[model samples]
Structures are given as C-alpha cells and as structure tokens.
Target: MALGMNRDVFITCAVTGAGDTAGRSAKVPVTPEEIAAASIEAAEAGAAVAHIHVRDPVTKQGSRDLALYRETVRLIRASGVDVILNLTAGMGGDLTLGSVEAPLPPSAVGTDMVGATERLAHVAELLPEICTLDCGTMNFGEGDYVMTNTPAMLKAMAAQIKALGVRPEIEIFDTGHLVLAQWLEKQGLLDGPVLVQLCMGIPWGAPDDIGTLMAMVNNLPKDWIFSAFSIGRNQLPYAALAALAGGNVRVGLEDNLWLGKGVLASNGDLVAAAKTTLTSMGAKVLTAAETREKLQLKKRV
Candidate 1:
C-alpha cells in the first residue's frame, strides 16, 4: 500500500564468509589479519557494523576456531576503529547427509555438526557486541548439505548468548525461520529488542524478488529491528531497497564479490558503493555510535 522509509539507516558489512569464495576472489580475506584489516576498511568506507566469519588461515576455508576469532577481534580493537563487532555463531551446524544407496551415516567430509554449547564457544569466549543465530535448519545449497539448527539447539544458543550479553542477529532465510524466531522470543529464551537479518537470494532459502522481500518485511515484528540483503548482483540494489523498506542495510564481499560485472571488489569498495546508493536515495546512514544507540546494544563484554 504505502512506501516504507527511514530518514536514518545503518550499514552492516559482512566481511569474509565461510563459503567457498576464497579461490574465486583473491580479495576474500582468509586469515584473521586480513579479515580484521578488511573490516576496518569497511568501517572507514561507512559500515557501522562488521559481521565477520573467520577462515582457517592454512586451508582458507571457514573455521570455528576460538583462537582465530580471538585474534580477529583483538586486531580490530587494536586498530582503534569504532566499528561494531558482529561475530558469526553460524558455524558448527553444517551437515552433508549420505547418498541414497548407503544413507546409514551422513558424510563426514562436510558435516561439522556439534552440540549447541560447542557451537557458541567462540561467541561466549569473544563476547562480540552482536552474533548471528540462524533461526532454523534448511537445505542450504548444492549437494546433500543442510544447515542444521533445531528449536532445541536455537533455544540453547539464544539463552547462552543472552547470558553473554551479546545481541543475537537472527539470520532469517525463509519465512518459517521468522516464525521460529518469534517463537523463541515468546518463550523468553530471547529477550529485549531483537535484530533480524533477512537473508535472501541463497539457494534453498528465500528468493530475491520484490514480492518476497516485501512479504518478509510485512511479517516483521512491530518493534523488532531488521536489515535485509541479497547476494551477488542484487547486493548493491538491496542496500537502497532495504532502506526504502524501512530497515537497515548490509553489504560486503560476504554476499558478493564484484564492484562491476567484470570487476572484483574489496570490502571497502562494496561498502562505499552501498553508501553512495543509500545517500542518493536521501537516507542518512548512521555511524557506529548512532547504530549502537538505535539497537540499544550493551557495552562490549
């Protein structure tokens, strides 16, 4: 019916993700040093928050190493940049099931499933201002892979994160995940104002389309905060679109790698591009302090 608009918005830059993108682009940060550097560059380019995922420096694959998380956060803090730290608790839940013939046990080559307590080990140790809680499990991509997070698992993770005083950024892939997140809140497992990230354009998740995005928006809780983004080419467009939808924005190499069709982009370039788009749309992008106040984040513990 009516357009949703917010005069002020905040930009979140998801630095290096655990996906298999390191080989495709040299700009993807592998080690903690590079990830930290990229996050600072993003903040300088107008990202209020840095949503980070560490990779095994040796393998260049996404890792859940507490040591890696510690070093990454340390370097970012040492740099004296004021970017809000948002570490990912989305690791340790990947499951690649067995083939049809011999499906007795799931494949171990890709399955990294662990208990709820183990999944939040890094989050509890690092205590980032924000950490993601993937609300539900789904067929995440090609192969037999499933990103697993049962209601029992989510409840345990949310309670632990709440105890740690870190805000849980509920990663919403499908509509049902949103319903599950609300269920968690109703159970008092998740308290206070929550943040939801509408992750569209991923396979086996919500599609990246206007109607789909709007549907997710319409279903959002009246008082909860939200930010939306799509991967690849839709990434830049979603920055402005998310702002128009009355939500905050997210952009970085985590979702897309190109500054243009033929160009590879660093995190800074993506954040700068998103900032330009949002500004052209007449929305004032908020700084880290402003975002902190708006989100009501507690002091970093």
Candidate 2:
C-alpha cells in the first residue's frame, strides 16, 4: 500500500470532552454558553468542525441532558458560526465498576449505561452533521472505568444514526475497534465515505507511537476518511503527523490543555496552533463547506 500526505486537511476541534478536566484547567469550557463561545472561537481560528460534549453547569460534570445539548446547539447556531457540528454519542456508555473484586453492581458515580435509543437521543433531536460512535469497549484509563461500547450497542447506534441522516464518526480507540468498524460496515450500518477518528494515547487503548498509528492507518478501509489525534502534549505534534499520514487532524482543550510549558490553551489557541503547524508544512486547511462537501456531510441549522 503506497502512502502519501493529505494536502487538504480539515481540523476537528473537540471543544470539551467528558473528562473531569473542567477544574484542572480554567480554559476548559463548562457551561453551554462557554462551550458555544469556545466552538465559535475555534471556528474563527480555523477549525472546520467542533466536536462537542455538554456539561452540567452546577457540577461541571459531563451530562447527557437533552436540554444541555439543545441549549449548546442553539447558542452555536444563533452565533451564526459556520462550522460543522459533531456531537458526541459516546457519553451514555461509560461503565465504572465498583472494584476489581466487587464489580457486579457497578458504581453509580460513573456507570451510565443506557439503551441505544436513549444514547442517540440527542443525535436524533439535534441532527448534527456528525456524531461519534465509539467502535468498541475497552478499559478506559485508571480504575474500573471502562468506556463500554459493545458490538450490539454499536450496531444499534449506527443504524439509528444512519436512519437519522447524520454522519457517524467512527471513533477507534484500539486496533480491534477498526475490526468492529469493518463489521459494522459489513452489516450495512456505516454508509459510504465512512468517517473514522483514530483516538490515540488514551490509556488501555492504542498508544500514540508512530508505529501503532501507522498500523491503524494502514489497516483502515481504503476509501474511509479518517482523522488522527493524541491526547496531552502530543496533540499539536500529531496534527502534522496526521496530515503526513494521509488523514485529517483533531486538536482541542478536550484532548489537551497546555499550549506550551506552563501555558494553558483554549480551544481557539489549539486550533490556531494546529493550523499554523499544518500550513507551515504546506498543507491547506479546509473550511467547513469544503469539509462538508468532501465528507458528504448533511449540515443542519
């Protein structure tokens, strides 16, 4: 398989993930207003897509409340920001066990396993251009926290997302996740020009090493469009690597917080940094319209 760099790249800014980083960094947007503002900032700074996850304003914790999603999307649309929206459908699958020995009951703190329809309720309601579908389940990070996404659950979600006419951004956290994506494709769940996100550097999943990334990229379906991103400091560096590896780029405060040593970065800062890096490498950053056309995304108001 011959490999070449992607001259036309689109940046997806994951404004704020479902992680507990709101208190860790002041730059992290907690409220819907803040998230919308950050998304607008990222778009203005050069992000073609905004990957969003709403949080509870009071607790500053990730929430699956339709009201939050509605408010956040409402604010972004009202702002007239011309950016593709990619709402995360990976929230309700979180399963945090009680402990290694007593993992039956499951800890209520983080175990939010819901039905497939309930999980994609926001996607059905908001009808964003793109929504994430984590391809497989894995032990996510420290402790008994498992980012659960069973094949059955995934297939159901994919079918629903497809039926809603929304693009499902297949988020692959490990190599096996690619197999799951392939299975979903075989099952006729994923539509053509399939979108994938190689989420790297998350613990217990695919590492951020060059070799692992290439392996994942190599095994990707020939025609599937993909983006690569690594959490923490590698987020900026991976922007160049992703373009060089023939994929798009994703960078934001969700995957990373620091711009440099002791410098916290906002979503705009991260998007601008990635844009400069990609442009310096002689790559053209695609706008929202260009990305929509290329990915055949259905943009909603």
Candidate 3:
C-alpha cells in the first residue's frame, strides 16, 4: 500500500486517566496542582493539547468534582501556557455488574452511572477548548465492568457540547464507535469541526495492529481531523504510525507509564519521546497556536 503520511502533526498529552493507575506509577499526577503542572510540562515539550482527568487528592482515584476541574483549568490558564485544554467528559458511566450469575444488580463498589447532565457538569462549568465524548458503549476491560454510553446519552451530550461551543474529541475505541460517531454527525449533533481519537490496544476494544489502525483511519470522514494512540509500550510507536497514517499523535502517563525499560515516565517524558519520534520520522510537530488554528478551536481563559 502507498504511504499517506501527514507532514504536519500535533500531539495531545493525556496527562492522567480515570483509572486506578496512580499507585502503579509515582509520576502519575493526582492533585489538581500536579495535573496542571504536568499539562504545562507537556505543552512545553511540544504537545499542542493536554488531555486532562482530575483525581481525588485524598484517595488518588479519578474524580468528577467540578471544583477539582475548576482549579485545574484555572491553574493552566494562569500559567500562561498556550496548549489547547481537552478535558475528559467520559466519567460517570462506569458499570460493574454483580457477577456472571447474579448480574441483576450492579456492584455498588465500581458502578457509577448518572444522568447525562451530571456526567457533563464539569465540561459545562469549565468550558475547555475541547472535551472528550466516548462515542459508544463497550466492554471496557476485565471482569464485569462495562463502559456504558447509550445512543440517547450520546445524543444528549453531543447536543449540549455543541450548544456550549466546545469541540468534542470523539473517542473511538472500536470500529463500532466510529460508526456511532458517523451517526451522531448525521443527526446534526456533531455539526461543526469534528475531531476523533482512535484508542487502540485496549482489551475488548480495537487492537493495536497496523492493519486495524488503517482500517479505522480509512473509515473516518475525509474532512474530519483525528489523532491515534495505543496504551503501554505501543504508545510512543503509535506517534509514528499515526503520522504515517495521515493523522496526529497522543501520548502521556494516562496511556503509558514507562519511558523505557524499567524506567517510569512523567507526562513530560512521554510527550518529549513522542515529539522526538515524530520529528525523527520527518513529521513537523505543530505548536499549540497552529493546532488551535487547524482545529478552529475557541480559546477560553
């Protein structure tokens, strides 16, 4: 097959995720202050966007506290860092079933389902330049946990996101998620500039293979913008793969914890590594300003 490489690319650093990864790596930022600092570091390291997920400073678990989101956004803007802020609006939809036999009632320990309005409370309050929209529901990972996002829920969130004038980074974990995104576009909920994040290599979702990646890329709307990343060791490698596939790149502790063998990574280290990889491939890493212009983002401070 012929190469359709993108000469110019922008990197998005997913600083931290809504997962139980803080204890696994000391570099994972938990507090709002730390999250903000990590984002600034990524911005300095050539990442045009900082994908943020706040954690409970006390429990070190992911949180959807509006105050935490507020403080984190405030600090990032106050530092005069110019990276486009992209907050995760994918929380509050977690579902952990009781068991294989008694699945009638969800497990109270891990299940966190809420209304669409509450799920996006942080986005409605913070008004970041870009926010995530998990495009479809899927069996997220192990055991009984399922990432639940029904069509009705997605439509409601997309409509509100459009009304708020915030760009939705449509997160496609599998091929079906991409189809759902197309459906959302057809429904006029995703009318404006569309951006997608192809999340690969997660168990029960899309695998991180070249052929699978290209298939997902080929299925995307020609005019839509996209970035791609895989978790773990494949994270940095995806920088080159994404650019080669005519897309952008994403990297950070949220997706991977290591800078090298036996070397834990900070968010900055991941972004720097991705930058070096993309640049080594002769791809020009775009700055924050250029990214904003390309995506037609509305900057709010």
Best by TM-score: 2
Give the winner by lDDT: 1 or 2. Answer: 2
Task: Kindly list the per-residue Cα lDDT of model 2 for residues 1-301, writing each as its tens digit.
Answer: 1369999999999999988899999899999999999999999999999999999999999999999999999999999879999999998898899888999899998899999999999988899999999999999767898888888899889999999999999999999999999999998999889999999999999999999999999998789999999999899999999999999999998999999999999999999999999999999999999999999988788
Which number leads on lDDT? 2
Q: List the residue pairs that clash in candidate 2.
A: none
Ranking by TM-score: 2, 3, 1
TM-score of candidate 2 on Cα atoms, chains taken together: 0.99
Error of 3 at 207 (Å): 0.5
**Ranking 2 against 3 by TM-score, winner:** 2
lDDT of 3 by residue, 98-197 (tens): 9999996999988999988999898988899999999999996679999999999999999999999999999999999999999999989985668999
Model 1 pairs whose backbones collide? none
lDDT at 123, model 2: 89
Per-model TM against the reference: 0.98, 0.99, 0.98
Instruction: Give model 3's TM-score versus the native structure.
Output: 0.98
Lowest lDDT sum, 10 consecutive residues, model 1, at 1-10
Off by over 4 Å in 3: 1-3
Candidate 1 lDDT, 119-198, residue by residue in tens? 88888887888999999999966678889999999999999998888899999999999999999999887766789999
